[model samples]
Target: MPLKYLTADQSRAARGLLNWSRVRLAARSNLGEATISDFENGHRIPSPRKLAAMRQAFERAGVVFTAGGPTLSNRSAGEGGVIGTQ
Candidate 1:
């Protein structure tokens, strides 16, 4: 099945919820910071592979994207340590 990419707003919101910088997400997702910045700024749409990489990175860090918005996983939220990376 094709993966659903996060919208620009959701991508920004997800990063906000995670308190993650583009650099951090880039490292986690193995994507360039410029690509992430462009995507978040609505300058461009990422490819399926790139989108999947970013989404997967967020998922691994306990971010949950919902129809409403992005949220922290219960486990991570309860722990009060949603900061999954440096």
Candidate 2:
């Protein structure tokens, strides 16, 4: 299913699953690190376009976003389980 929306906690969980720093995600998503940090910290929500770019970057790196949270793609599943929100 397509992701209808992404939560700040979910974004942080995805980053933890991927072992990605804000700088790396920002670089991959073509966004600024400050933007990512702000979003993850719940200070601001990104525009749809920027959020799409972040999701695409994580998906390309084998992370899958689900209704429950972020999980590894089947291709990378051996590494770990789902990263769920609190």
Candidate 3:
């Protein structure tokens, strides 16, 4: 399956669903808070490594991104993904 990237809307929703603030996400992702701010605000697209950091952090917090409906998962699966070399 092709990877499902985090759209800005999804990013915001996911954070809310996880009950996390941007600061928390940044801490978990090991990214600067400003980076997270820019990403969420659509002012920037994170680099692949940074994006992966964000995705993995969210996954660890039990936020799943699925192709179907709004079903959630508790899996700590963080594999087979690449945000590209940007």
Candidate 4:
């Protein structure tokens, strides 16, 4: 399945939904404050570690990240099943 990357706005919204302050996120994810600001402001791509940290933070806030595409499990039927659905 093709990966549907999140737009900067969406990313920022997700971060906001997780209630992560820029400083707190930077500290927890080991990212610089300016880097986090740029990412939130659509000026930069977050590093892998920062992405992972964002995912973890969202998880802690009960926000699930779902890919917007088909998965191997659902490829045969073309059903709109989630990638990691049990």
Question: 2-84 in candidate 1: lDDT tens per residue?
Answer: 33566666667667877889999899999999999999988998998899898888778767655543345566342311322
Q: For each candidate, C-alpha RMSD in Å? A: 5.6, 3.5, 6.5, 9.3
State the local distance difference test value for candidate 2: 0.75
Give per-residue CA lDDT, model 2, range 1-86, as digits (tens): 14645667777877887789999999999999999999998899899888888877776776655555445545544343354433
Q: Is candidate 1 or candidate 4 better by TM-score?
A: 1
Question: Model 1: what TM-score?
Answer: 0.76
Q: Model 3, stretches more than 4 Å misplaced?
A: 1-4, 69-86
Give the 10-residue window scoring lowest on summed lDDT in candidate 2.
Answer: 77-86
TM-scores of the candidates are 0.76, 0.77, 0.73, 0.52
Model 2 bad stretches (over 4 Å):
1-4, 69-86
lDDT by residue for model 4 (1-86), tens: 11233335544555564456878766765667787789778787876656666545444444444644312233233222222211
Give the runs in model 1 whose Cα sits over 4 Å from its true position: 1-3, 70-86
Candidate No. with top lDDT: 2
Q: Each model's C-alpha lDDT?
A: 0.72, 0.75, 0.69, 0.53
Error of 2 at 31 (Å): 0.2
**Residue 53, candidate 4: C-alpha displacement in angstroms:** 2.7
